[model samples]
Target: MRLSRAFIRAVSSPATVAWRSAQSRIFCSSPSDYRKSQPSMLKHLTSKIKATGPVSVAEYMREVLTNPVTGYYVRNNMLGPDGDFITSPEISQVFGELLGVWIISEWMAAGRPKQLQLVELGPGNGSLAADVLRVFGQLQSVLGGASVSLHLMEVSPALSDFQAQTLTGGGSQKADCEEDPVYRHGTTAAGLPVSWYRCLEDVPAGFSIFVAHEFFDSLPVHKFQRTEKGWREVLVDVDPEDSGKLRFVVSPGPTLASATLVQANERRDHIEVCAEGGVIIQQLARRILNDGGAVLIMDYGHDGTKTDTFRGFKDHQLHDVLLSPGSADLTADVDFSFLRRMAGGGVACLGPVTQGLFLKNMGIDTRMQVLLRNCHDPSTRKQLINSYDMLTNPTKMGERFLFFSLLHPSRLAAPTKPHGLKLEKRSPVLLPVAGFTDLSFS
Candidate 1:
């Protein structure tokens, strides 16, 4: 997008920079300041480290982001305009609408399965789910009145409450036991069955289309650095000089992860392995292979090309990751190459395609034009245009975010011909289906 003074001012804002930029640690305060500011979490971490020595970055992230009592995600409703960061779904209804269309499109290609469970991992505020559900309602006839249900995998009670309120209008009932597979249940405003789970494994197996937007990036990652001796795991340790804070330190010797996670042929001097993300991908792959469905993962990530992407965000500005505990959001860029490998050979993995290209292939431009044509309010129309720019502009979210998928192997195989019909050369699933193909749009 051409940068006007207004555009420059907007993108240069703390919120935008924090969400999209690659910045180094900005230590505005003492590393130990976290002890005074958020002592509950920081003290807990410092105490743990004092007792047990350095912890894995993965463990540190798990505690900081989802520590049940004091973690950021658990204690804060930190998303959207008024919070830590904003996501594409919050930027435009068109974002969610296009994805919703893709979900239904995939379902149709699967021959309208008897049961369709729309599963979302880390559904933030349920905005995406609401938009997808709306699209399903609009295409009821195309769905052939198929049994459709919404299954959400969320770990934050605060966010789940918000999601339940947003999607079901405060109608969901919490499960009696936290151990129950389904932790919550509700009927959407449109009367579709909706259920919530704390993990993907708890979601019942079915012909499900899994959607994860900006989800995998939050999974904890283990950082490693190569030394003359061998690869060593980088761990989070309480800085001896500043007992109130944390810092990264390399293991003195090889740790189990350093030995097991790093590939023998790996050439990078520095590497980060998200074993947790790999496990999730494996689960998704196994589900698609056995039960017949697909998985779509969208996030800001690298194709295993980036190193040292771990950082923190608070109120839309970069925060020193090591300085504070449980006071900001922590994340890293997902390594698509690792995920693809973990997916194994059974499922066909599609592009880690740029979000701009994927959405355009999914017909985002056409969708935008239609929305503009229907809306009459000047402010609303202008907002729609700006949102379009923000979402698709290459230098903005468009390039930073990407779309990747895992489909049942058969989805890409030659289509079986009906009784007397001729067999097409390309798989129907590859013909402009889900934007993985380069489809020409009018």
Candidate 2:
């Protein structure tokens, strides 16, 4: 379908949004030094390291990302062209549309559950959720009038406001939002009740279809660098030469916490592990195992191996990890192997498939053809084409990003295989899930 000017406005160009722009700066004061020009989180980290010694990469990421006042995510629009990076949903409507379709297909495959909790994690500006809602809203009859409760897990106040505005078509200035610290509930344009939570655990109990796009990578990971004697924990410490600056330093070797990596690592090799991610996957897997549902995670990461993928971004460009602290977005590769192991034998885990292959298998090419034919404007057509290339291009987000799905075995009639998860594995469950043709789940 051809998008109107308003739809175009809704899917705004990242370059035009001021909040996404790198030029936007947030200022703050620190407890240690009132006159320090650095961001408050930066000063806070420095003081923390000075007083408590260096911290693990996971601790550093947690503080920098969600640090109430000066954290990057809490205060900024970190998506789109103007932001540190542009996610697939922001790049084109096709991405979200296909995802929405996939959700519907899964729901249908599950015998059309009367009540489904459609949940999203870290919904940036709520664009993907909004698009998903839109698609589902249009297919009410086909869905047999299934009731969907939209739940968004977003800790950032600024991003939550944007999400509410996008989904509900109104700002969240109500008395309840201000009064409720733990949770705030609203309704979308379609009258579907929307609830916001600070974390995943707060979401109400039910069979859910969870979607986490680029969310896992943001979870903090502890980095371990192998040394001569043994693996040591990588810590962020204040630079001795320059007191105000921060640098990474290795802690004492033979770290017990990193003992798991002894066999996986070699001398001088670095490995990253996101214990938080594993905990979350375990929780989600348990929920899915207990209650019939599925979890889809799309992010950039490896198949559970050793690598120093932790990095930072500022103003749509790569930035030094230890330079400005919470002023920039810090992220690392999501180790899918860790997630798989976390799932254990409770749920069925699917592909760490490339985003490009998943999307193409899901029929992005056909969707693009439809849009291109409907779109007459040369400029819009060009924009759509470029977006298609960017999303599917191997040199771009295509190969870098992965599509991982976790399904409850009960969702299918028997233990049947789902698309993308069709590689050699212990489980013989395989089905032709749309968008995963010929792709090996291994």
Candidate 3:
């Protein structure tokens, strides 16, 4: 699809226009002044693009959404009702509560380790963690008072502060100091008391539960397009016209370095390599295989054939991936196939399940029904329905978001191969008989 004119305008003057709209409530403004500021910005952007070669979609998105100082994520509050978009936990308490239940279940299945590590990647505002812990506290007696050590893998200091605040508030509400969760910050493998020389090596050897929601998609991705000659890797460089502008340009790099790019060459033009995300997945899988544990990956993606899934988001609206320099959100779809393959042997990989189906299977509907039973006002009831729809409606986020689970081999009674490993499916009789119930319910 071609870039929209509206997106062009937004990208060109994102700072002036987006900031004004975002902060409008804080500082009321007249429409006339806003209109006057737009043309100049467009002219500047047009001149810059002309001087520079056509920017790639990825380059445009990286600049507009993630520019070090002036990027949207850096300058704006991009979460909750006031921000550009809302995440699942931000949408409702029940979402996190349910996820907590899942984690507790996994913890129990791991034989209830004495020193259990609960880790979250890119824990925005830590709302999900707080909610999960609240539910977890309620089930502590059954799960046993397992020493809980909370670790958060976050990059942004701004987000770290927000996470600290949320954890503190939630921890205060818990019954006692012993029950209060310990908080640490760094990459999933870094922040925790784990030692490793490399990214994959950093994962501490232990029975741990890992959760990453809306995390993988944000990692840097390499874009590629197939041609008669071969596939090429995309790179970002500064645009000459606008001193501060950056644009996507092809890099003369070997495609073999990127497995996804090498595989995508057989397909049509335009593909994305989330090699970074895949590497992280492999690391997690290795951790599970070598030590023991489970990982819950939740994000928007597909379980179908491969295709170009790179895109951008600004102020809750989709925009051309190549619109601005470091000012917008740049992301590519998660390839569960790649993850499944990377997990290799001896791992039980489950579901690229639809968020709607998974949540429903996990009792979201039952929870909603319970809430509606006590809800007295019609307006409040309607609001609850809307929230549910936002979460589960296919066109909304329900079908779009996907959930995948990776479990340790020892925990599963059956012999299982990782996804995409080309292993033959065993018969029901031959398969391990340990059901999901064999795992402890935290």
RMSD list, candidates in order: 10.0, 11.4, 11.6
- Note the clash tally of each candidate: 0, 8, 18
* Top candidate when judged by TM-score against the true structure: 1
lDDT of 3 by residue, 151-250 (tens): 6675454676667666763222211343223223222211223111112334446677888899877765556655445665454343444434334555
lDDT by residue (269-363, candidate 2, tens digit) is 77777766776787788788877778999999888654878888888888777776776799998888778876788788887888887887777
What shift in Å separates residue 57 of candidate 1 from its native position after superposition? 0.5
lDDT of 1 by residue, 1-442 (tens): 1112243233212222111112112212334445466568888988877776677777788888999899888889999989989999999987887787677667766766889999999999999999888878876766776999999999999999999998998789998987898989999988999999998888998999999998988888888888777877777766666677677776666666676678899989888888778778888998999898888899989987888888888899988877667878999999999999988898989878888877787778777777787889999999999999999999998889988899887876633322221222332333324331221221
**Candidates' TM-scores?**
0.88, 0.84, 0.71
- What ordering of candidates by TM-score runs from best to worst? 1, 2, 3
Cα error, candidate 2, residue 426 (Å): 18
- Candidate 3 TM-score, true structure as reference: 0.71
Q: Which stretches of candidate 2 lie over 4 Å from their true place?
A: 1-36, 171-182, 260-268, 412-432, 435-442
Candidate 3: clashing residue pairs, number: 18
Task: Give per-residue lDDT, candidate 1, residue 136.
Answer: 82
